[model samples]
Target: MADLSKDYMSNSADPKNIQDLTTFVQNLMQQMQDKFQQMSDQIITRIDDMGNRIDDLEKNIADLMTQAGVDEHV
Candidate 1:
């Protein structure tokens, strides 16, 4: 395998640099979380629309069966 430990050893200096790095990571994580929430909201809205359409279809089917003299209770 390639020497990965050497890369981590290179940045083992200066506490201020590490603090700045932590702040950058936290900001990135927050932005990612906001984007994820937006995507989830859109998915939920689409699911609700699909559910409404399915309900409409079910009602139409029942109406058609009734018009054809088919007993839905059977």
Candidate 2:
């Protein structure tokens, strides 16, 4: 992996400047990570919702088949 800290520090030679740059990059990365996690959670919730919908549809189909007298033995 690339040395992200060094790269983000703009190759600063001064110790204090490098430290400030490092902090800035770290905070920015943390914010991005939080946003990504939120998005992932939302996607998972949506997938679970879709799965529930599919289960309901399956039950409806089974009920319809029963009412139509489709052979249960099959």
TM-score of 2: 0.73
lDDT by residue for model 1 over 1-74, one digit each (tens)? Answer: 24566655656555777889899999999999999999999999999999999999999999999999999999
Clashes of each: 0, 0
- After TM-score superposition, the amount by which residue 33's alpha carbon in candidate 2 deviates from its true location, in angstroms, is 0.9
The TM-score values for the models, in the order shown, are: 0.71, 0.73
Pairs that collide, model 1: none
Best by lDDT: 2
Clashing pairs in 2: none
- Model 1 alpha-carbon drift over 4 Å, by segment: 1-15
**CA error at residue 11 for candidate 2, angstroms:** 11
lDDT of 2 by residue, 3-45 (tens): 8887866657678888998999999999999999999999999
Q: Candidate 1, which ten residues in sequence have the lowest lDDT sum?
A: 1-10
- Alpha carbon lDDT at 59, candidate 2: 91
Q: What is the lDDT of candidate 1?
A: 0.91
